[model samples]
Target: MTTFDRREEGFENKFAHDEEMKFKAEARRNKLLGLWVAEKLGSSGEAASDYAKTVVATDVDGGEAGVIRKVIADLAAKDVAITEAQIRVRMDELMPQAIAQVNAGT
Candidate 1:
């Protein structure tokens, strides 16, 4: 392949990977926020967990990232010590299951 073609292929690959990474990262952030809110609300056991799931789904559907971050930051400001990265990881872990449960409930 010509050098230009090879460079173009590499750029395309990088772009695709970056997009995928962004999607995964956003999912994780949402899930992490859900978990934090569930804990903050003191939800526990099966019944309480169902309630928490509902809350998380609601927040996610609203599509208000600023609100979510504000809440997270507020909690941290009060000493929760949560960073954005931590939120992302937690959210990624829980968002998929949360989405599934929500879809089933609907």
Candidate 2:
């Protein structure tokens, strides 16, 4: 007689994947926010990295959407050329692979 092993994926695994996707979306948003802020601040190199961190860190206390809104608002307040339209366009271009990476946990 031959025996095979079988297993059932649990609800937790499904939920975990959902959370992972959410996180990945957030990371991509953070990256875009960083670039936006860097451009707005006329910062490059370490300063840009620092600004990105500051913006992303805000999400650590609040959440991903909050950080995104802050970055957009801050740039707008400073009269940067970045518009909500551009942000949405960039996000549309970036989201698919980001979602894949998130699902893969990379």
Candidate 3:
């Protein structure tokens, strides 16, 4: 293979890996957010964890909007009284931590 071909392949591989990491990070952030909300909703231990996993399992059509929209509606239904701004803020706050956690996994 030519050097140019090798470089192209390497770039593709790096892009794929970066995308995977982004997905993992987003999922982790969703899980963390879910746990926070679950605790506020009075769930704990296994129940809280399960709830968080469900949050993480939500399908993302484009970006975090799917997760955030679901969470906002769920919270409203439970009368938890949170705002979209708050959720977005929390998500922004947790992204780096989630990324680090996901990247550091065994």
Candidate 4:
């Protein structure tokens, strides 16, 4: 392959890797968010873990908005008071941690 061809291939590979990392990071963030919310709702141990998994699944299927809606609804049902702005702030805070976790795994 020519130099240009190799460069293009490298760019494509990098793009794919970045996208994968972003997805993993988002999933991790969701899981972290879930655990935090679960604690607020008084769930512990295995129950908390299962709740986190559900949040991750929701995020995978419906993106950030889905995660937010699910968390908001669940918390509201349990009489836990939290605002979307707070959730969003927490999400932002966890993003870097999630990306770091994903990078470490890779």
* Model with the higher TM-score, candidate 1 or 3: 3
What are the clashing pairs of model 2? Answer: none
lDDT of 4: 0.94
lDDT tens digits, residues 1-106, model 3?
A: 9999999999999999999998888888988999998887889999999988878877455357777888888898899999999999998999899999998992
Q: Rate the local accuracy (lDDT) of all candidates.
A: 0.59, 0.71, 0.87, 0.94
Model 2: per-residue Cα lDDT at residue 76: 71
lDDT of 1 by residue, 1-106 (tens): 9999999999999999877665554444454555565566555566445544554465557554653565575566556666677666666666676555544542
- Among all windows of 10 consecutive residues in model 1, the one with the lowest summed lDDT is 23-32
Ranking by lDDT: 4, 3, 2, 1
> Could you give candidate 4's per-residue lDDT for residues 18-72 as a string of tens digits?
9988888898999999999999999999999999999999987988899999999
Weakest 10 consecutive residues of candidate 3 by summed lDDT:
57-66
Ranked candidates, highest TM-score first: 4, 3, 2, 1
Candidate number with greatest TM-score: 4
Q: TM-score for every candidate vs. truth?
A: 0.47, 0.62, 0.91, 0.96
The best candidate in terms of lDDT: 4
**Root-mean-square deviation of every model:** 8.1, 4.6, 1.5, 1.1
Candidate 1: C-alpha lDDT = 0.59
